[model samples]
Target: MQLCAPVGCPYFRGMASVVVEFSAQEPERLARWWADVLGWHLDTRSGTVVQPTGPGVPLRFVVSARAKARKNGVHLDLRSESHDDQNTIVERLFNAGARFADIDQSSDVPWVVMADVEGNELCVLEPRKVYADTGPVAAVVIDTSDPRSDARTMATATGMELAGERSEFASLRPPSGEGPFLEFLESESGPEGMLRVLVE
Candidate 1:
């Protein structure tokens, strides 16, 4: 398929531009839950929103009556500045209604797997310098059969710069002075797991 780079494409990669979108059958409820958790702005009657912080990205919630088809192949990997911070945040998330999700993950992993109220999964990771200066929403990642091919489509469609590329993986991020990245990876095995994202 021919990829599209929208009109005014250059500016669409701005930090304040739409960075991510979530779909929900009960949009108001799910959106509100996350908004509160993230300290984002919430308007239950409309799309979920989060005011940009510094060069952070903006997020939105869209209405969708359809049930999730399967576990998401894309998910959020949240960053932490320290192990203590990671533990505290995980504890807070548990108190706020997030629960550990056993996605065939081992207990020794550096990241904790947890599911939102609606069963969407997310990870809270130990501090890594790459994300040390990024926002609470660090990166959006997905699995693909071919990172190079997928990166091309993503780059053409969103105007995000091709930040990095290698044999097994590729990443796209908003241009300099913009926001976080959107990554694509070619798994040793094909994708089949717990991660989902709504991009439309």
Candidate 2:
């Protein structure tokens, strides 16, 4: 389906889009809550939640029937440019009702995990230098119904080319090699999705 642009949206243009589909029994309620939390809008008519970051940066949420089983295999990892900045953002998120995840980072790792209002776990990491100098921090495994189909849609929407595909999985690398490699895996359990992003 062709996406219609929202009038006067600040970020209505971009070359990258990230779409995460979550399975919720009460799709409307969940979507509404997330829309408010993320400062996005909801198209209740279509039952799709979307946040347009820019012309190309589209963050979408799709609802399904699967119950949230366990911690997400793929979690969004956000990073800040500096410690002070990270702390500030973390505090803000916490105050805004985000729950903390028990991820110890005293060992020199760059990131920490936290849970969203719905108990969906996400990570907040340090600067890219930590990963660049220290190597990969973690791998995200995306659980989906049809990984190949989802991967293809993402590839088409984000202008990212599919590097490879396995029996029931597909891999996508962001435009910049700096971002994490996103792998899509087929799951019968339901739509438990994850994503990673650079905060600042």
Candidate 3:
């Protein structure tokens, strides 16, 4: 399983890129819902929707024919600046129709897991320490059917430039370098059946 650089196209522009693929019985509807929620525009030509990223990776949504088998095994862990910020954002997401998942954050860890409209899981994490100095987390590879296409759609919506693409993968980098390179992978068992980010 080799990852590829992004291919040059009209959508390639900025830096960070985050790609998310959804396995839905109704891909177009789900994609449209996410587009509105993320404040992104839909690229009808590509049948994908994108949310532009400011100096960060763009968010993308891909449609799959399969139904979600189970809760996503591997998902994103987004870091928030503070507790108040986390609460505020979480409320916003909930109002936007995001469902909360079970996680024990009261102990020490500073993160919460939540599911999107389709029941795909994602995490909202708090910073490790107060004003902790650290580099942004790189790309997160979610399980998907077509990562390259998804990456392109994200670039279009977010206004981020497409960097390059390799054999089975695509790369998008934002100016801040705070976002991860979203990659799509093919699976024989279908998108929703597996939780592993990488097969190997």
Candidate 4:
């Protein structure tokens, strides 16, 4: 596979996109929850699929017998307009069957951790300018042992541009710079997160 440059990686001019597939015991129910959360349309005519109205990734929910046993290393981060908006969103989700989750995060963190009805972890983050154009979902974060290397590899594989990098974090996005960012976070543990990822 072709590797990206350390910095200033080349863009693929929107030739690629990513689809996150979730495995759940009740696919339609889980898909409905995410569809409501994202203001997307849920189509269960065949298999469960959540389709976005505008720019965003399409999520697919597949039936699985396996249960979620631990924290998800790959999770989504929702964008908020402000502090009040963040709280409102969290409350709305709580009423919709979402529950607060603790993944060893400190109390002072700017984001609120939550899990869906099926124990799938996600975050509602404080407002930030960088995620202003990313629609409802800000980013799909993957916990990796080496953020830099994994981000670079994923960027190359997905034909996305390397957006930015720090000591313990890295980011990638489509060449058009629209939609949610794909982030890699440095973690000490091994891969024990969500199921499948489809690049198209």
Candidate 5:
């Protein structure tokens, strides 16, 4: 997702986690899908149906008529405790309306790529030590035209520490150096829109 243009919002620019709102033909349906998958409650009281997940931004889905053109540049990477857990979760996701995503990855790929009810891409990763402490979500990755600049902007805005930076990629973690990370990688014309943001 693109960096938010925070101006006259109610909360301070850096004080709040960036809310990830998706444009969906059926906001309610999409919201329900995520809520079911994440086991979180959906809040539709304030217009958008939201499912807040920990310190990260609340996942919100807004009603839109326009359909998405391609796979998103930003997607969720869900971690598993073991191979069995991964298979279980993948089965649950498909049962709940998720479908296999043909991302050109062969059967040897370690992660399970799937699309949400509205075709938003997400990966169920096999358990690894790196994500042992990051909780269920491993990280939020964004493909950017300029990786370093976008990473710097996000680090400054969120007070996240820069873990690494390069022309092709950059990574950031919270000030305390815990939880999920926000990563940026160089690419041509990344998908544009704000869907979900990793906030702490």
Candidate 6:
């Protein structure tokens, strides 16, 4: 289960690199949507890519014949600077084809859940001190049956530090400690269309 570092990983150890890829029916459109959302530049020269704006991993979208059929196992949680900014981001997303997602989250939760144009769920979270330095994206969360084990595997493979762990979630951050955290969340649902860390 070992993975080498990728070119853009902030803490790359020069072994290999990592990237998060999306399989989309319309790769270009999906890539554009994400690029706009993350304020990243879209690079279509090689493929539909959302180039990393910081130390965060780059996102690449490729064509897929099948459409999304269920909730995604992987999703992004966007960080907001303030309450007003959170509201503004949600509003902008809605105008760009995002819709509210009902994932059984509590009504009192501080985050707003919404699905992207392609039915991928994402969270726009209220400001939190812990994520203040995590750039635009707060975390790349994966739903797993065993959060601790998965988190450990990912942390080891990617040279990330095990940042936190609780009953239902385990989190990791790169050695540099500034990019988005990789969080494994406890869930009963099996993995569906999910994030992949490709090491080359």
- Give the TM-score ranking, best first: 6, 4, 5, 1, 3, 2
lDDT of 1 by residue, 1-200 (tens): 12222211122444223345566777678777777666656643434655454445555566666766666667777778899999998998899899998878887999999988777778898887766545676677777789888887777765567878998889877766344567787865444443333333
Give per-residue lDDT, candidate 4, residue 124.
97
* Candidate 2 Cα outliers beyond 4 Å, as residue runs: 1-18, 25-45, 55-57, 62-66, 103-108, 129-200
Residue-level lDDT of model 2, residues 146-189, one tens digit each, is 88887787677655557669878987765544344456877775
- The CA lDDT at 72 in model 5 is 78
User: Residue 44 of candidate 2: its Cα lDDT?
Assistant: 52
Pick by lDDT: 3 or 5, better one: 5
Error of 2 at 137 (Å): 16
Which one wins by lDDT: 1 or 6? 6
List, residue by residue over 38-141, the lDDT tens digit for candidate 6: 88888887767787677566787878888888888888899999999999999999999999999889999999999988888899999988887788888888
For each candidate, how many residue pairs have backbone atoms clashing (under 3 Å)? 4, 8, 25, 0, 1, 6
Better of 4 and 5 by TM-score: 4
Question: In model 3, where do residues sit more than 4 Å from their true spots?
Answer: 1-19, 56-62, 103-108, 128-176, 181-200
* lDDT (tens digit, per residue) of candidate 3 on 1-200: 22334422222344222344445666667667656654555555654544443322233355465677665534555545678877876787789788987633365556667777777676665654421321132334454466677667656655544656765666555533344444444433334432332210
What lDDT does candidate 5 reach at residue 33? 83
Pitting candidate 3 against candidate 6, the one with the higher lDDT is: 6
Which ten residues in a row are the worst by lDDT in model 1?
Answer: 1-10
> What is the Å distance of residue 170 in model 3 from its true position?
19
TM-score for model 6? Answer: 0.90
TM-scores for all predictions: 0.78, 0.53, 0.55, 0.89, 0.83, 0.90
| Candidate lDDT values, in order | 0.66, 0.54, 0.50, 0.80, 0.71, 0.79
Error of 2 at 128 (Å): 1.8
Candidate 5 Cα misplacement greater than 4 A, ranges: 1-14, 53-55, 193-200
Kindly report which residue pairs in candidate 4 clash with one another: none
